[model samples]
Target: MSYHNKVVLVTGGGTGIGRATALLLAERGAIVAVNYSRSAAEAEETVQAIQQFGGQAIAIRADVSSNEEVVTMIKHIVKRFGTIDYLVNNASITRYIAMEDLDAVTEEAWDDLFAVNVKGMFNCARAAAPYLKAGKGAIVNVGSIAGMTGKGSSLPYAVSKAAVHGLTKSLAQALAPDVRVTGVAPGAVNTRWWAGKEEQMRALIRHLPLDRISAPEEIAALIAAVLEQPSMTGQILTIDNGQTL
Candidate 1:
C-alpha cells in the first residue's frame, strides 16, 4: 500500500524504532501520529523534524497499557485525520534482571512488563480495529527475538514478547480480509534501550554473524516493507543481525 496521505499512529514513537518508523513513514507522505507515554519532548521533536521536512505529523500522549488511553488515542487520531490507515504497536517495557535471578523477577516486574508489552499491544489493536477494518489498513506489532529464543534481558520480558507474537497472529485472524496484522521481531539495535547495558550489547555483537548491531532505521525499513507487502499477514519477520543463528 502506498504511504502517501496515509494516517498512521505509532505508539512509543518518541525514540528508537518507533521514532525511526515515524520519520520514515512521514517522509513517504503518511500523516503520522507519534504517540508517547512520557517522552513528550522526544515525541514533539519527532513532529518538529517531520514538519521541517514538509511532512505532516503530531505528537500524542497516551499510555498504551491503559485500555481507556489507547481507545481515546485512536479516537483522537481518527477525529483529527478523518480516518485511520495504519497502526504500529511499538510501545513496550522491560526489566533488566538476569534470567536466572528468579528472586529479582518480582511479581511487580512480571506485571509491569506484561502490562505494557503484551496487554498494551492488545489494547491498541482492539481500540484501532474498527477504524483499520473500515479503511482496509494494516497493523504492525513490534515483537522481540527474545520471544522465539526464550532468552533476553529478563524472563518476564521474553515471555511478554512471546505473548506479543501470539497476539499478532490472533489479531491477524480476527482482523482478516479487511485489515492485515503482522509483526517484526528484532534483536539488539543501537538505541537508548542499550544505555548502561552497552557492555552487554558489545558482547552480544561479537557473537552475531553479522558482527554488528542493527540500526533503528534498518528495522524501520523492514517495518515499512512489511506494511507495504500486500500478501503478507500473520507472520513475524526477524532482523536480528544473525543473533539467533
Candidate 2:
C-alpha cells in the first residue's frame, strides 16, 4: 500500500492504458479520479470496479484539451481528496490517415491531435502541479515508441507524443525540487486502441527483440514502479522490449 491515502488523477481512464493504470493504482490503495471524455458509462464502470475492490474512486468527465474543464476537474478532485499525490497524463488521440490523403491530415486534424495529445497533457500538468508539489507527488506521462521512431498511425500522433517526452523533461527540471516528472514510452501494447490492426502491430513487434507485444498491465507495472521510486525523474522509460535498439 505504498499509495495508501494518496490521490491520483488519470486522464482518459475510461479505456486502454489509462484504464489499466487507474485500476491498478486503486487496487494498490490510491484513491483514483477516473477522467474520461465522451465515455461516462465506461468511466463509471471503472469506478464501480474500484469500489467493488474496496478502493476509493470517482468518475470525472472532462475533455482534457479544455483548460477550463481541466482546472475545474482538478479543483473538484482536490476538494474531495484534499490533495493530489500523482497525475498520469494518459489521454491521447490518433487517426489512421494515409500520407497520400493530405487533405485527411488537415489543419483540423493536426489541431485536434495536438489539442488532446499535447495540450491536454500540458493543461493537466499545469492544473495539478500545485497540489502535486504540495504532496511531493509524481507525474507519469504516457508517451509512445512512435515518438522515438517513425511508427505511428499518423504523423501528428508521433509528433505530439514526441512533444510529450520533451514536456516530461522540461517539467521535471522546473519542478524537481518539489515534484517528480517522468514519461513511459510503451511499444505496441495490446489494447482496444489497436484491436482491429493486430496484423500491422504484429509486424511492428516482430522487429523488437522480444518478438511480442506488451500487455497493458506490463506497461502499468513500469508506471507503478515510476510512481514508487522518488529518485527517478525527468526520464522517459521505454517499455518497448528493446525496440529502440
Per-model TM-score, in order, reads 0.98, 0.95
**Candidate 1: lDDT of 35?**
98
Candidates in order have lDDT scores of: 0.93, 0.90
- Which residue runs of candidate 2 sit more than 4 Å off their true CA positions? 99-103
Q: Candidate 1: give the clashing pairs.
A: none
Top TM-score hit: 1
RMSD vs true structure, all candidates: 0.9, 1.4
Scored against the true structure, residue 84 in model 1 reaches a CA lDDT of 84
lDDT of 2 by residue, 4-70 (tens): 9899999999888888999999989999999999989989999999999899999999999999999
Q: In candidate 2, residue 179 scores what lDDT?
A: 91
